[model samples]
Target: MSGGQTQEQTPEAGTTETTPKRLPAAGRGGGGPHFNVGMPGEKSMNFLPSAKRLLGRLRPYRAHLMGIVTLAVFSVGFSVIGPKILGMATDLIFSGVVGQQLPPGTTLDQAVAQARAAGNDTFADMLASMDVIPGVGIDFTRLAQVLALALVLFVASSLLSWWQGYLLNDVVQRAILRLRADVEEKLHRLPLPYFDKQPRGELLSRVTNDIDNIAQSLQQTLSQLLSSLLTVVGVLTMMFVISPLLAVIALVAVPLSVVVTKQIAKRSQRQFIAQWQHTGALNGQIEEAFTGHELVKVFGRQREIEATFATKNDELFKASFGAQFISGIIMPSMMFIGNLSYVAIAVVGGLRVASGAMSLGDVQAFIQYSRQFTQPLTQVASMANLLQSGVASAERVFAVLDAQEQSPDPAEPARVTNPHGRVEFEQVSFRYEPDKPLIEDLSLVAEPGHTVAIVGPTGAGKTTLVNLVMRFYELDAGRITLDGVDITTMRRDELRGEIGMVLQDTWLFGGTIRDNIAYGDPGASEEEIVAAAKATFVDRFVRSLPDGYDTVIDEEGSNVSAGEKQLITIARAFLSNPSLLILDEATSSVDTRTEVLLQHAMAALRADRTSFVIAHRLSTIRDADLILVMESGRIVEQGTHSELLAAEGAYHRLYHAQFTQPVAEADGGDAESDVVGASAVTGTLRPRSPVG
Candidate 1:
């Protein structure tokens, strides 16, 4: 990385603070804490932008979305038409029976005589035009027919809505599937620093739970929003047609409801955001605790862990309760306002009816429209939470999707072929963070067929050097080359293919023993796999298993002993047959006998091949062709063991501190192992082929 390049700043991930952080306005909008029910530590999303981006994602499904919306309009339209038609039937029944009553002071017989005189054919019509009794004069056949037609419209409307939901599901789910796949692929492209800052569970939640929320809200709310909006529009149109005065009064409630809902919604947004943030924090805690349950139990810190969990859980609860409670009142509050509007409409319409300015049927229809108008208002209020929550989740998912990717590969990468295992660090400099430089002006070379040992105390930048060789990170200012060609010019894949590594922490995937060994060279033949295993002495124990090489290894190869895991990794390296090999504490986890066997096996593997061995045990690398002593990332000393001992420099002091005391104990008094300088008590040694 160039020194001028800087790390991108983001919200401090995995913060334990219960209070939500205020995001800056430049990247994510800066606002006061917003509520999201049960979600804690989640960033408050820019609703308009996130929704726009979300809509952009649904562009491919425009036709399906339009169809769902159109169907929703029709469904609500048909539902709205039902009551009016029923009211018409009510008028017809009232006229047919109740309106047929004899006029005051006139007997039924006198009305019948007048009707008969007009002729029997016109008599029924005459009777229907007259007043009789309220509701008693209803035409049973007509009433039943009207009710039956209403049922058919309702059923048809229901079926259409169901079909619309099904189509919406297909469209929304497919979009979500693509999004999830993108997130998974993005994980591989993200830089190491991204993972260092973010928790794995947080990323998982973004990929899994957040995207799922968007899909679910799309499925449920999309149709409902469309229908509710149409109903509002339809009810308003009907209300104005019935009585303009009453419609105006009913309209009064809308603004009041909106004002109330807006205030509540604003407060709820912060609560909802806090809820999700706390939820993510809680999940991260659980994941960390579970992964290290053994360590926690060993340390007897159960109570402390429980108390931490309780704190997180309580934060989550308070946030969720706040969000739900605030949002929960929207519907009831709108309903109460609606009732006030209903009373106002009724009183005004009653005066109009008495003054003969409006008919009873018109007043009734107006009342029905008023009720219908308020219902969609309530829905709109409730949808505020769903829409905001869904948008919040979408913003998180998009954040991951839009994260910075790794540096792009060269357009035309150079190929490394038949590499001769020569690696050199030329005036190298690097730092994980800007202010702290880890390595400065580091220069070193390892030639083919030489065992180069790197010895240093912990955090001496030993592993950092190995990381540079493998190009896990970019150099700040340096040129690292393989066989005199700058490695950066070559494709990373081709370069890594020429090197193999075995680390102190063994990594074995969940697979059969054969598969784990063959992971490096997937196309390796069975004979090759077994030969590699035999060379590493892995075959000795593998043959004793009931399934032999075919036995399955549990996750991280926990079913196998640490020694066994190391042996398997060594076998994997053997199968790769790389020109250069790296061994980092390869024998540290094994017993004394196992260590002796592994050391011999490793020595044999290193023969006639360039190797870099990082070791804390000085005795293990006594026969190394060259030893490089490192302190704080700089090479302080370099020479053969005897040459460095004679110089009495850094290497000599380290050797004395580690090996000399042990040798004195093994011998009676003098530190002698082979009639040499402290060598006689240490162990048998080959003649010193000193290099200075």
Candidate 2:
């Protein structure tokens, strides 16, 4: 509705091309022409900055985040200590078993010395390290105590981990909630021109899909990352406390795992970027195809649209497959390295136990710690892909949040108090682009309660003239005034509140007929709604339906005819009862009979209100108090219909072109005959009442 073009022709500048071009294969980073609106070009994946900013969103919940971290530490700490306590149980049983083999009342040291004398040094050394008394056999009492302690530790760890997960969920949800609100507010603040440069579907993807992905990634990664990191630290500390030698061996695999994860993540990150980009592009294609489905069928371009969809879908598939395949390599690679470390730890640990350099229970506990250390490392490696994908999505969403917003409303806005609807444009110049000037040095005025009709060929700046008055765009130079006050000084809402517009393109949300009409004046009573509808002829057709005013309009309003939709929109404008009215091809879709009826209705509605009418049909504006003919953004002629006819200028030629009939000369022949000839070709029009 805020486009730079007139109703009938392309704007001189900033014309959008709506043809799809084949993009380069995924990961190649080659951009292509978009189908409807321009797709944002590929950007370099800045992982750290984007990830940091995304996490920064949670700064408001820092206290809850800290609590979650503390819980994770305690949870992992208890779990890490469990294996050591179980190892003490193992020691109790082993000492009892060895003591049972010794003679009654024999000391452990004496037994070890006797075995050493028999040249069994390894067995003796193992015996010397055990805390066994002679004739003792598997002390089940002490073993049960140790087992109970281990069980308590494990259960406590489980409870803490569950509580940590619960808290993390809350923190993540609150952070995402704030983020969603920010994005919604950002969308409304963006200028209309910003939307012109972006496809709706692509923008929707950033707001919906990308943000959803970010939420999921944060939820999954943050909780697991916290627990896994704490587990790694706790397990490593326990491993060293048991056997520093084995801990060093387990850590030998860490650098290798790091290298593997880093290499694979680098490759997968680029693929993820490509994947989401293609996803947005494909969504844009689908949206365009569906929106213009009927038009495509009319033009027989279904096959072309299908082919384009297939191409984009294939690109998304390639990007998705590559990302998954590359990232999938990380888990197995890390596990393989961990297994190598396990083997080395086991071999060295077994030797230490055999030689009694370490107790069998200590060696056993160290092996368990070695496994725990590798497990969290593997988890971290596996989660790298999720983190990469999420960060990619965050960058996309951040782009929207960072987009330049429109100029803010004035701090102290001017109020009209009582609007008269006298509109004036003085020395105004505007262009969609800097080099291509569409409207220049334009000046015009409409007195209060006057109907000013603008007639022009396509691209003649007809629609643009009204757009300026509404301040849909800021002027390059000069100013427009409403009731002698500069429109720029007034808040956009206040200025637009005084005006009602009915464009050629009618938009109706999914709702009942009454609801759609009520959108113009949300507080309007039902009686008022019916009056507006009846005046605009919407009531006549609506009553034909079984449900009448309550009949639901589909999302696309496909149930109604084009003329019916136009009528409903006109009713909406009428209900607003603004001081000023703008009708751009408002009756273009209606039939000749309906147009005649609407013209009369509009004439009555225009009473006591300044109205601007942009019409391509010459007959509709014949009775207008002032008719302006614009060409190439300049006013070529201005006069009443009969006055313009007498001038024999651009309007005279345009009039003849429409009727394709010769008319008597104003000076030489009867003017009444000319009026009759014109009325014969076009339908008769009601005489306009003199402006008060």
Candidate 3:
């Protein structure tokens, strides 16, 4: 099962169409801001585990984390005290002005005694020591001292906050760096099926977007969370100290604000998930459309593709707007509740102040503390969504990291001492899924130096056969052997070291031509690289370029023609000099001239080496030692081209379909000569062409 394909169904006409069953949607990895629940095709991950794993990532930075916490404590402590100290100044100014207007018998000390009687002994003691400045009638000396200390505390707090942020960035960056490295390493350990079923954009988003979300959230939200928490605690403590009555009034808003924030955030989680999912889906669509732009234009489906893209984009917009709008309400809602509490505190604190139950300075301090308390409440409420998104992203990253890795190399494994390239698959049985049998009890032998050609239509087991040989997918039963040694007993690396493959899809990295040709054996000398290039006839094309072997191939090998890229890959295989070679439609994309040249090159490369050639062009493999025809993942016919043609089997029809046309001539009219004439007409059998 491929994506979007339904299961087999019986029609009203009573015939069943066997559409293969699809893979389960779970464990197919992608990363973005996603909801933990209530979304189509998204896995609901446990928040606690994801959060625990995220914190585990920070274990290595425990010391730095502790230092940051300590700094946060100091930073908040000084900041919290500044408002209280500033309140003292306000009281000092108020008392000095009021004392001068007092009755003739009242002294400043007596006024302080009266303040002590008013249940504010702290304020009374602070006022008794203040120095009165002449003519000013206020304590400028005490005010200057308090203001100076407040300035120092504020500056110190600001410095510590900056240092904490700096340290946090370093710690967070290191942790995310390790996380990215782990995700990349996990990619290598993942099985081929994981890549086969998942889209590239999806996987890339996991590695990039998901991790980035976690990083951004940690960087911004982590420190702010700590600061907000400390501020809330510290402000609440100061509020109660200023006046327990007003503090009780401020506390009334806490539970109410929390209830409102929780309600909105719960709805926003689903929307966030939908938003990111749609974003990822849109990205995948755009990637496909752009990568296959020529196909879109040639097929005149540009408008159709655009419409599909617009639909996905619209969904993303709606989801994003909903999530942000819902989450956006948190700040203002908390602020509204805080303002209501502020009104209540003001009216109540005024009555208490008029009764001389509280000083002007204490009331001012209480008001500031109330504001400070509600500010963190608003911040925490806003951070709720970011933290949710982070946890969601963390779950995605952990999903990949926790997925089943490929089987490890066995301890003290068997090693192929020397490879002579005799390959065999005996009684092999395998299937991608149990219900869909691909290969069953298959047996085959390729003697040393034999060019065995496998010809099949689409969906034949050609690729799977090669994959089995390479141990990409383990066999369900029986064994594959190289030189009569069961390949599975040997480690995958040691087994693959003796074999080389050229796939239909050629891959070239961003490097010079020489570098790509020498990729199989990176240490190959300049002379060896040159020889391999010449052997595969890639030297002709190299010489045509301005920089010869030094010419750079851009990413995806777009700078080179399809035929040229194929030849370069062949040269890469030639450089490896393996004892066994597998070519799966290696020449499918090449021109007739290049295919002819490649055939000769392959002949040279296959000398004294067992080779498996998967070909659609029957003309190129007419002289193969054996030709196997496959249908529905099983070999239906096997023999030399001439022998199979003489038998008038499946291979015969396929051969004639490609090289021979329907004619009045009977079947017995010179089969060998007719083959040669057909080959000449197709220009596919000629090895020495102009590129030579």
Best by lDDT: 2
Candidate 2: worst 10 consecutive residues by lDDT? 26-35
Question: Which run of 10 residues does model 3 get worst, by summed lDDT?
Answer: 2-11
**C-alpha displacement of 256 in model 1, angstroms?**
1.6
Q: What's the candidate order when arranged by decreasing lDDT?
A: 2, 3, 1
lDDT of 3 at 595: 81
Error of 3 at 124 (Å): 15
- Candidate 2's C-alpha runs over 4 A off are 1-37, 661-692
Evaluate model 3: give its lDDT: 0.77
Clashing pairs in 2: none
Model 1 segments more than 4 A misplaced = 1-44, 103-137, 140-145, 350-364, 607-609, 661-692
lDDT of each: 0.74, 0.83, 0.77
Model 2, range 1-692, lDDT digits (tens) per residue? 22223232322235444435532221111121222445656667999999999999999988998899888888999999998998898888888888898888878888888899999999998887778888879989878888999999999999999999998889888888998899999998886566655666788889889889998999999988988888898898888888888888899999988888998999998899999999999887787677776766887988988899889899999999999999999989988998999899989988998988888888788888888889988888888889998999999888889988878889999988778799998999887667767789988899888899998666678877887888767888989999888999989999999999997778889999999999999999999999999999999999999999999999888999989999999999999999899998788878999999999999889888899998767888999989999998889999999999999998997787457433343223435444554554465432455999
lDDT tens string, model 3, 1-692? Answer: 11101111101121122211221231221111111111225555466777788978999998999999999999999999999999889877876775555445656577677777888776555456454322244678988998899999999999999999999999999999999999999998886655554445556677788889999989989899899999999999998888888988999999999899989988888877776667656655666567566666887988988887788789889988998899898988998998999999889887776666777778888888888899988999999778778887787777789877878988878866767799888999987666667788899999989999988765567767877888877888989999988888888888888989987667789999999998989999999999999988899889999999899999867789888888898999999999999887788768888788778878888889999888766777888999999887788999998899999988887767556632312353345444454554464352343764
When 1 and 3 are scored with TM-score, the better candidate is: 3
Clashes of 2: 0
Q: Model 1 Cα displacement at 156 (Å)?
A: 1.8
Q: What is the RMSD of candidate 3?
A: 7.8
Clashes of each: 37, 0, 2
Pick the TM-score winner. 2
